[model samples]
Target: MGKLGDMANKAKEMAKGHPEQADKGVEGAERMVDERTGDKYDAQTDKAADAARRSYGSNSTTDR
Candidate 1:
């Protein structure tokens, strides 16, 4: 597999057991993007974060 595919597989494995950390990772990445872009893409970022949350968030969380 390609590097990206391998990385994705690793991330999937990591998230399988530690969903909260996966959620935090998504939030951190969103924050970094927002910071770099000076929040100009807040709308898009928010939407993406929501999708990520649904995918990675714990079942107990509202977003999930």
Candidate 2:
């Protein structure tokens, strides 16, 4: 795996123990992107962010 892949795996492991924080991080990132893009991709970004949040053991209200 490449360095990015390695970092991803490490993050997943850390998320296992800090799911809430991970979810917050994902949401924060999504919000930042949406703001930067003027909400153009808000729907898609929310979907992906929800998935990422769930992967870390957190359940997001936006996940449906």
Candidate 3:
């Protein structure tokens, strides 16, 4: 596999072991993007974070 694929697989494996932290990481990224865009991309950031949480098999938290 290529480097990107390898990295993705590694992330998936890590998330499986630490789903909560994985979800937090996604939430942090979403917040960073939203803040950087001055809330202009809040909707898209939320959608992406939700998708990432599902992919990581993690429960969503009330952090918004």
Candidate 4:
């Protein structure tokens, strides 16, 4: 749980100043999950990305 919190914080920071980096982070995280779970959690990646964006308060449609 602590690690998850830390990741959330990092994602928020990335989304705040560098959305592209946040996107990359999401992709990387997804890839890691796929590698670990044998692609069993493909749908969860989008949820993770959305959560990260929301954590940063940058989930808006407009570019920030």
Candidate 5:
């Protein structure tokens, strides 16, 4: 697999073992993005949050 695929697999394994940590990481990433973009990309942030939650096998905190 390529580098991106390898990274994706590693993240999946991490989420499977520690969902809460993954969720926190996702939240942190979202915050960083928001700060960098001045909250102009709310949709993208929400989408990322949902993807994070899904990766960890948890329901998305952000309502679609």
Candidate 6:
């Protein structure tokens, strides 16, 4: 597999039983993006974060 595919495989393995961490990571990314854009796209970022959490099998909700 290519490097991108390998990295995706590793992330899937890591998120297997650690979805909360994955959700946290997604939330952090969302927050960074929000800050960078001055919170102008809060809804869009939140939706994107939720989508990412779903992809990682994360049921944990972000408090941010």
**lDDT of every model, 2 decimals:** 0.76, 0.83, 0.84, 0.68, 0.82, 0.84
Instruction: Mark the 10 consecutive residues where model 2 has the least summed lDDT.
Output: 55-64
Q: RMSD of each candidate?
A: 3.3, 2.1, 1.4, 5.5, 2.3, 1.8
Candidate 2 global lDDT:
0.83
Candidate 3 local lDDT, 1-64, one digit each (tens): 9999999999989998998888778878888898899999888888888888888787775456
- Per-residue error for 2 in candidate 3, Å, reads 0.7
The parts of candidate 4 lying over 4 Å away from their true place are 1-11, 57-64
* Residue 11 displacement (Å), model 4: 5.5
Model 4 quality (TM-score): 0.55
User: After superposing candidate 5, which stretches have Cα over 4 Å from the reference?
Assistant: 60-64
- Tens digits of per-residue lDDT for model 6, 1-64: 9999999989878986698777778878999999999999999999988887777687777775
lDDT of 2 by residue, 1-64 (tens): 9999999999999998988788778878998999999999989998888788777777556543
* Candidate whose TM-score is highest: 3
Candidate 4 — what's its lDDT?
A: 0.68
Backbone clash tally (model 4): 0
lDDT (10s digit) by residue, model 4, range 1-64: 6999999677577688887666667667767887899878766765765676666666543221
- In terms of lDDT, model 6 sits at 0.84
Which scores higher on lDDT, 2 or 3? 3
Q: Which is superior by lDDT, 4 or 6?
A: 6
- For model 1, the local distance difference test gives 0.76
TM-score of each: 0.69, 0.82, 0.88, 0.55, 0.81, 0.78
Q: Poorest 10 consecutive residues of model 3 by lDDT?
A: 55-64
Q: Is candidate 4 or candidate 6 better by TM-score?
A: 6
